[model samples]
Target: MRRPDAQAREILALAVPALGALVVEPLFLLTDTAIVGALGTDSLAGLGLASAVLSTLVGLFVVLAYGTTASVARRLGAGDRAGAIGVGLDGTWLALVAGLVVAAVGAASAPTVATVFGAAPGATDEAAVYLGISFLGIPAMLVVLAATGVLRGLQDTRTPLVVATVGFTCNALLSYLLTHGPGPLPGLGIAGSAWGTVVAQLLMATWLVALVVRGAQRYAVPLRPHARGIRLAAVAGVPLLLRTVTLRVALLVTTWVAAGTGGESLAAHQVVFTVWTFGAFALDALAIAAQALTGRNLGAGDAAGARRTTRRMVRWGIGGGVVFGVLLAAGSPWLPALFSDDGTVRAAVTAGLLVVGLTAPLAGYVFVLDGVLIGAGDGRYLAVAGLWALLGYLPLVAVVPLAGLTGTTGLVALWVAFAGGFMAARALTLGLRERSGRWLVLGSD
Candidate 1:
């Protein structure tokens, strides 16, 4: 009992900083938008296009962090500190190589990508300029993602918190200086914005690499990449990659559905989705905590301890979800008003928020079990299960519009399908696997 409570404390310790670190990413982008917006409408639009392109690619590679965390945490828990650092180094290598490939591709296709994204006629050239310049930072950004995972696995979220905070501050300052070009620095317009962000990314990656190198040295781990280790990581990451693909598909389908409802509905969806994203990311901190803690306990051959840790996390998830749900539901009527003054838009948003409140606790269940399973290195099952969840929800995505629900009421129906139905599908799958207790992979590979 006390042991579980103690583990709860540990989970919170990790989760709180992880949450802080996580928000820095959005804030960084927001800083870019604000600074770039002053450059002109074309520049602002270009930044939007380039940022969307950058984010989709980066999102796909989040597995780098997830995979590295699992590998490093388990290895360390198995009492192989050197091995842990070695595996993390391999992840860095993979990130570097992957980042380079994306940079090359993006640099070459910046113009084509902007066109495909339907950049407005006036913004197309600017979008290409911004995107091509932004490609310069892809490698460093990927390296930062991988390195963050490495530190997280080492049970040091605080380092990433410091790194992200400092990096965000630097990025904001650099963007302002470069955009304003107050002294000596040439304000290169959109190009300057891209360059400013790139400079910050490079600095962040440099700091992270230094941290990883120092850790490797302390653990007596070689900084060189391991061929076999890289192979192992790739195999482990593939399933997670597909899992992410399914998640992306679901979001896109939901967006498509919302768009089909018309501009007002689309606007309402964006507002609701933004809030949902915030809630999801916040809950995901618990999942990250679950990953490191569960992996460590399992690696140490404490299956019982792992179970206890997971159950405690689940309890925390449940409590947090319930609290969020209550608050969301209570404020739903007014929350939407913050985003819009239109009664129709507010009504739709309010309906969506209420449904979100109902599903928030369910999402907590999905996220925590997802972390627990991933921590156990059960990626194969997760991929399949995630696909199944997507399958179960796609029909609802199609039906929301077919059901002929429009306006605020229509938005309500769409959300019921998207939030309520889709999340329940995930909860069902995760819950089934959890009860089976088969996700408890005994130890590190």
Candidate 2:
């Protein structure tokens, strides 16, 4: 048996690169945020709403990655490489179809989405401009997500790391040039950010497809999409989809609240949310490791292994969270400067970060356990748990009206509900589930 230290090493080997890749993935938006922030508050606020919409769609479909990882890792653990590859194949096709649908809907409803967010006039128009152009990239982004899942399930995080690095670098260069209109290219403002993302996503998608095709060939995995396998993936994925939807609804509601608070609050909330997402990548790395490890262990019929790994991952998750929380608190005063020059925006962002920082450990506990449940393929339970958590968060949602809160104070209350109330709810449910030992199903597929 691998000792605890060995387990730690194994998880880190998978997680560290994952951490890098995850953080870098968000840097694409971070790059756009910084560049557009320089254009002024209206531009930044517009990007916030548009990007929020895009992220919500992407997140809702993340079952492509999550379901694929769990299924592939399980099959591979049971010594079925072909089955693993097939999971990835189905996931890729699903992502493509899902993306196409999202693109169509988002393109048609871009203005309405922005309008619903209650952004000011300039911000709403800028949001529509960015959202319209950004829809073109959803297919590419979904492909990339599915392809990354294939490699991740195959126990190779480094390839995705390299892909993210190249993609982000290209996006930064393209967005910078297009934003400035250095040549014949007109300075497209927020629209430039969308175009740059599309260009980088196309390149990344092409590269990822090549890698996936090569894997299929090497494994002798069938090239055609299998209807049964695709349905199986969707069956496993639908519950998680609902889970993702609830999460996005929470975020969108929060964004709407921020929008109502005023332009400065909206702009600052963007920066704070970006920082939370960035810090989440650290904890998420541990969660990713948990997904792969727990699935593999359960598939191997090694319950002890899964339990041990879960304990170790929890430790790793909380440790990572503490470190990130410290960094968040320490850097909040300066990090906002990276995205905005306005004093009021910076101050609002700083206040938001403090609340998020205090709850980082709670987030860590919540994330790892959540991954463990997912890795064990308990999506149905997660679906129910998500609803319960969302409902539990509703009373806090009323804090906006009940407390007569507005502006930064309102944003702070929202984060406290988010980071404190919601995450705490998840930790409780997942923690109890883990102790119950009901999620250890294996070898049934």
Top model by lDDT, which number?
1
User: Which tens-of-lDDT digit does each residue in 36-97 have in candidate 1?
Assistant: 89988988888887887888888889999998998888988999888888989998899898
**Stretches of candidate 2 above 4 Å error?**
1-4, 34-46, 111-115, 118-126, 178-192, 255-272, 327-354, 405-414
Scanning candidate 1 in windows of ten residues, the lowest lDDT window is 1-10
lDDT of each: 0.87, 0.86
Candidate 2 has its poorest 10 consecutive residues by lDDT at: 1-10
Predict model 1's lDDT versus the native. Answer: 0.87
**Candidate 2: tens digits of C-alpha lDDT, residues 317-354:** 88778888898899888988898999988888999999
Per-structure clash totals for the candidates = 0, 0
TM-score of each: 0.97, 0.88
Cα error of candidate 1 at position 32, Å: 0.9
